[model samples]
Target: MDNKAVEALTEAEAKAELAQLAGALAQANILYHGQDAPGISDSEYDALKQRNALIEARFPKLKRPDSPSEQVGAAPSEGFAKVTHVVRMLSLSNAFDGDDIIEFDERIRRYLGLGDVAPLEYTAEPKIDGLSLSLRYEAGKLIHAATRGDGAVGENVTTNARTIAERVAEGRKLPDIPLLIDGAPDVLEVRGEVYMSHADFADLNTRQVARSDKQFANPRNAAAGSLRQLDSAVTRRRPLRFFAYAWGELSAPLSDTQMGAIERLNDFGFQINPLTALCDGPAGMLAHYDKIEQLRAALGYDIDGVVYKVNDLSLQGRLGFRSTTPRWAIAHKFPAELAWTHLEAIEIQVGRTGALSPVARLQPVTVGGVVVSNATLHNQDYITGLDSKGQEIRGGKDIREGDWVQVYRAGDVIPKVANVDLSKRPEGSAVYVFPDKCPECGSPAIREDGDAVHRCTGGLICPAQAVEKLKHFVGRAAFDIEGLGAKQVEQFYLDGWVKEPSDIFTLGERFSSGLQQLKNREGWGEKSANKLFQAIEEKRNIPFARVLFSLGIRHVGEQASNLITRNYTSWPALITAMDAAAACEGVEWDNLLGIDGVGDVMARSLVMAFAPGPERDSIDKLTGHLNIEDAEHPDIDGSPVAGKIVVFTGTLEKMTRAEAKARAEALGAKVSGSVSAKTDLLVAGPGAGSKAKKAADLGIETIDEDGWLQLIDGL
Candidate 1:
């Protein structure tokens, strides 16, 4: 209800307290999220977070918005042309109790058809509490260091990385710090935990105390807070050490042995964790987890839980990745940290596409160690607790404002809305209903049939829709108009120079004399504005594919737009075809539908967007600025991936799947769906799946990703 603030502490005192709090919180959060192990109790960590927030609030000037209180840690560095994590890091569906773990064991067995196979092998070690860093080593030299920002693209912190490398390389002060870049090899992205021992954390805090300085609450926080320092030297001074867990891009082969791999990494100068081991199977893995769990109270450094990875490199390659994580691995975490808080209120946030998403405001509570005030409500149906009363019911539970709710973070990211305490609900509260009208423009909203999202129909008039539309029209994914980022778009809209997608084209004529003034502003210059105008001109001649996607058609994405453009060959041809077949049935859609992944849904989306609606004027306006469409579909008769609804899974020993897909499209085979009766062949690599089964059921042949490559090789 009130901003909890603390009296101002001196600079040294603040530093000491911050360091201590950082270390402690980091340790607790690591155990709770990463290892599924719990060290300190949830209540204890919350107390520390409360203290941290109060301190931060009281001395607002001393507070860094990038502080632990506000930021989601630091973003990983991107100096070397960035590499997307092939495997998205994901958490296992949890079991709060021992029964849950047992059930997880059973599910794995059921899915893998391992009836009574020797018990699962898990390599349980202390889940170190610290910032997760991805290190790329080519031939074994540390090339990059990044924070696990969004699990996708992180900030490029090569400056701090180089500092850490210098310190570790010189072996001057902190001799025990981890080092994976011996002489700097090729690109190998290795991920691990960076931590300071609890004793060291305490010692660091004690020195501060002796100097009348603030003390760190714990070791984990110390590690996380220390490493994120913008100045690499500031980070280097901290007694930070790294304990590697996983890997990304690698060059020369690692060792043949799993344990040997860790040993080799250590030899290459990486500080592999002392506790990692090679367990036979599930039994060994569980046993390790049990031993680690049993030692919960006392450990050299703060570790929340343990990580168990399969020992076989080849099997790991076979398992590959899911939407965001790896199939070969799962963090078999111990019981996670949980906290209960009251749901204060719920608000609706309109996405760029006009879809209304639910956001929940909760009585701030510390889950793990971070204070969470907001949680995603998922969707309208979810907000109404619709599924709770239906087939997906969780014992008919419901969410109401003021009801006590459980909250926890999984895999150190994505805080979830857990169960709620209905008994504590406040009176007069009813189900949170999604609005039927656009909050921005008051136009009626509609929930399209096949989708779960409820979208606003106020296409041109809605402020939210207009701003987002203008932004998208100049977005990297769209026109890629340089100097026209969201800020510029917002300014233009506020200045009335732009509104719909078409308005972007008129900016040149609208403010040619004034346009020169933009150069004098903060980030502007003559060169910059000229560059922007030049970029704008370059994009005037729109590619048919980009233009289609840029039009902001509902279901049409970059890839889908490309598909339609290819089938139609040119924009005029595509428009004419759509117009002629406007009233045509499935029969008409099928004529153009033979294009890979094209269907009625897609055809209708195009017809509706380009159809003469009120937004039509905006399209016409775009013409003045946009270059004429210059794209024609290539002859598809010779393409390789063409008709093969290709689904790539598991690891390919060769090139990345992105490179592979691009290569496949160059040839003339129409890539089919994700594997069905229509699919000519299912790429059945090491981790071939339910899709492969469905393919087989439909009598479709299955091939490894490699075999698929071979089939189209030299085409």
Candidate 2:
């Protein structure tokens, strides 16, 4: 967007832009930090953030609640144990151009009351585009290393860190400093970036492709994935290198100045950025930035930007911090790469829920550091130039087959079409039309009103939907059956060995008695087939919640299934309730609808699935073959909210309604939507009228969101 156009945006336009920026940044964070795969380039991410900051500055009052300005990296994945940092590892403010750096310096001088009389020195270093780590050393011996998760907390990856290189190996590389540095403090926390060099990254990708494994998106992602490995052996195989740029908690100070501290760190046998230098002022900083930018292509490792920090420790302390960033530093980011690729064709994939996702098959091209052949089209609207709100985007232009389009990947793992180069359009090209029918089963694919996706209405009858459902059934969140994946399920389905969920339990008996022996298959051995059968048999006694989710009922996700199971406690009780609810709209139906977040749509979907039909029959047959355990709720001993049905109404001031429900549920409470005779507590927020009055009239205990929080404070 042009500067004039950005300056002239209306309040509503700014607000809309902010929402889009927030969503994009959040998704980018998830891809970068959680999945270790960045969909977008660092420059693109920085640009988005810069745009968001500009918009927020323009209309401060219109700032969204989930602004990227207030956030750090994505929340850490659940696989690692979270380590809270004693001193917060805050992110730096961004600078897009030389003018931004000048402004930053001037702002710093004004804040410090220096009046440009004294030369304020700064340290400019290459900002490594890799995973951030904080290593703790006690008595100069390396203890633990953690990844910078959300700035305040991180994932403990000490074992993974050790796999990079043992203390002996690392110590042998540097004769200046031993494993135990002499006269070092009892405790020292050195913060740095863990990165994979370009050569190593390419070598790793080569090995990955050779082994037929999924190639990493980039060096940063490869480094992150390697460093966060639960298995140290996997990390040990990757060629990961580290560069110490800063420090956290320290028993004693290393040096008085930033450059001195870095020098001290280098002396302690840690790799520091070679480009690290002391800059006189903004001019020096810009000069260094330009030099680094020119050398970026030749750098052995990824460096997204150059970081400029106040050289003096005292000055940095005085400069202090903004809400989410430090005033003492800023990262000047580089530009993103864009390449024109031919859009060969568009393919549609039918998901378990029947949503048809469009994927663009493009001529292989390199964007940034990753090769791209496929990109997500999101939905039909995205291809035709209309957004989710039906707003005209890209001048109402639609992408076409055989057309040259600019593809770019920001932190997004999936490459996206930035723009279509219409000048190079293929002669006599026609607008690509989305399929109205499912390719796999000839089922009529229909788009529901207000929904962007086109879905196959054939349900279980569609082979595509059936296979997708079966895959989800045995997914990690579901049955998670060993030796049974999408490939295995498809094979079994083709061989008529498994048709429904019940068939999985009877596989051993079928193979033992039938003429078609399991060991006769090309890939099958007696032991392997027996192992598969044994795995299936072990999963026969499943949890009720897992059983409910494994059915692949539409709109009944893991959490909703858990809620239903907890409410019913048993498979029989839940089936009986669902069956009764399906017969007619009565108390049972209302009761199902009363579950918090379970509205008319989800309730209807559940009841329809349970209605007397083949779906119910299949579910019943599966249930007959399994010993399903009743739902177990954690006991909140001596807690007032335990096992009580609670309803929340209106806009909560202290917390989101979803958060409220989650907290209440965590405290062993059944959070419902509407006030009812069964409701033990009513959390009525401001603007709550009907539900509040109803609760009051029904003689139920009514409280505000704060009151509810107070009740569950200890528990």
Candidate 3:
């Protein structure tokens, strides 16, 4: 968002923007924190957060309780057991410049009631751009290990840690961490970063390419994914290194100062960063930061910034912490690296939802040690130099091919176009025009109000959209046919063998009947064709939720589809409800709307989709060829919330709305966004508005989060 647009936003607009920001950040947290894969670049995520904080400062009262500021990383995934931290693993607030570092020191001094001239000592260390890990030792034996997930709780990876230790014990030397510290205290929690060196990362990527596994985007992600493996053998095989810099839940104090403690840790056989140093004041800290910045490329591992913390443990205690971060420490981050490159061409790609996304093909240039050839345009507005709110950006200057564009890789993630240098514009260059028609089908591409995307109107007719939908059907989260991938899906669609969701199941039968010969084509052999056919046959008995998601309806994502399927349970039940709801507004429609996360918009989209038309006809045709299994309720014996429809309303004090919903869903409850008669429980907190009143009038059971805890505890 631009400054002009930010300044001109109304209270309502700000609230809407905040909600959107919260949702996007939450999804990013899930992808990055829970799944160990990030969907957005660090710069994009940081920009959204900065925008959210600024808007909140301007309109504090309009801030939602589920604001990103109040949350840490996402809730832990179900793959591992949850470990509640003895001391909350806090995240650090960031500083972008030398002035911010000076301010941090000033604040620390003021907090300690010390004079500005007094020498406030500090320890400056490279802020490792990797996964945070806490290793707990009881009686000098490593007992517990976890990732820093959401601060309060983390995923238990003790087995994985022990496997690494066992491998190290077998005459194999890993990186310099002491898996078994001899002189450690009775109860010591050694907190540090788990990172992959440049050489290790390159070797791992080479192996990934050889094995046909998905390559990690960066060293940080590689380290995280490697460490979080459920199977300890996998973690043991990875080239992982640990650097201890902090402590948690200690039985005894290591030293009087932070730098002294780090030294003690090194003496105790932990690998301490050689770059970590004691600084007298801000000048020393800033100099060390600059020194680290200069040495960053040669360091062999990623360090996005330098962290400065008060040396004296007592002074640090005096400074204390804010809600999420400590006031005694700050991370002074490095500026993003940008390089100028020529834009070769602009291409539009169609998404599964039919939205057209533009990509910039740039002349390959090195940015932050990575080769950059393409960057996302986000939408047509970005290409036209307009913000999503249609406000002027970069003085309304449009980017064109052959322009010298600045491309930057933030946190060594996705490369993006930062700016275009118009001074070197080519002769006869004109403003690039986005296509008005769909490139694949020549259909009118229209942009709806309040949406930043332009979508093709030809839903089924457009080959791009149809092929994308087919690919989604066979996606890892969907049918997951092993031999049939994007290439096969496109080829099948082009060959007129598969055009819709149902056509996939008929491919084997058609080939058996001599109607289509798949083995005759290039890239298709007898064994591969048979494997593809067998894979298609295996997906014939699919679950209801996956089938719903495979249909490619807008606003109905995997989670939403799961909720809908769990509520209806069967294909016949869902069809009956949708058919009844489409005819008129009644109990069936209200119940459909009543599903906890189903809002009016989602309900309308679903109902309209299931109404008599191509969509309904396609679904009906698809179901006829397969046995759609009923959604199975999770096995939560004696749980009070099992199979219940729950609606959470108002500002939950103990947890965010997302947290409450995620928790409820984990316990086998349907979390509806709105309250309705079908809702079995109403979780109302302070400031609950109409939903609370509606629930009360409907005689639904109402309870607060504390009551929720009591109910789950009783179970």
Rank all candidate structures by their lDDT, best first, as comma-separated numbers.
Answer: 2, 3, 1
As for candidate 2, its clashing pairs are: 38-411, 39-410, 39-411, 39-412, 39-413, 40-409, 40-410, 40-411, 40-412, 41-410
Model 2 worst lDDT window (10 residues): 168-177
Name the candidate that leads on TM-score. 3
* TM agreement with the true structure for every prediction: 0.64, 0.65, 0.66
Write model 1 residue lDDT over 1-715, tens digit each, in one string.
Answer: 1231234344444433443454345434444433333433433344455456666556443432113443232223222233345533333222233443455456544434456665555444566767677766555545567666546545455565555555542233443333444543476676777777666777788877888965554566667666656666766666666776666656655765456667766666566666676676556666777877777667666666566555656545544443234444544445556778888887776655687766678887655545566665556655555431123333556676777887664333334466777777778878666788878888888876534556788766678877876766665446766567767888878777677776666556777765577777777888887777676667778777778777766546555676676656676677677766665655445555555555555566666666676755566567656555755434566555654455555555465554455455555444543554445656666666676677778887777866876787656
lDDT of 2 by residue, 293-376 (tens): 899889877888899999999878656665568879999877677788899998988876677878789998767775667766
Q: Write the per-residue lDDT of candidate 3 for residues 79-114, one digit (tens) a residue.
A: 678898999888777777787788778767655567
lDDT value, candidate 1, whole model? 0.58
Note each model's CA RMSD in angstroms. Answer: 12.9, 9.5, 9.2
Candidate 3 regions with alpha-carbon error over 4 angstroms: 1-41, 44-299, 305-335, 411-414, 513-525, 648-666, 683-693, 702-709
Give the CA lDDT, 0 to 100, for residue 273 in model 1.
Answer: 66
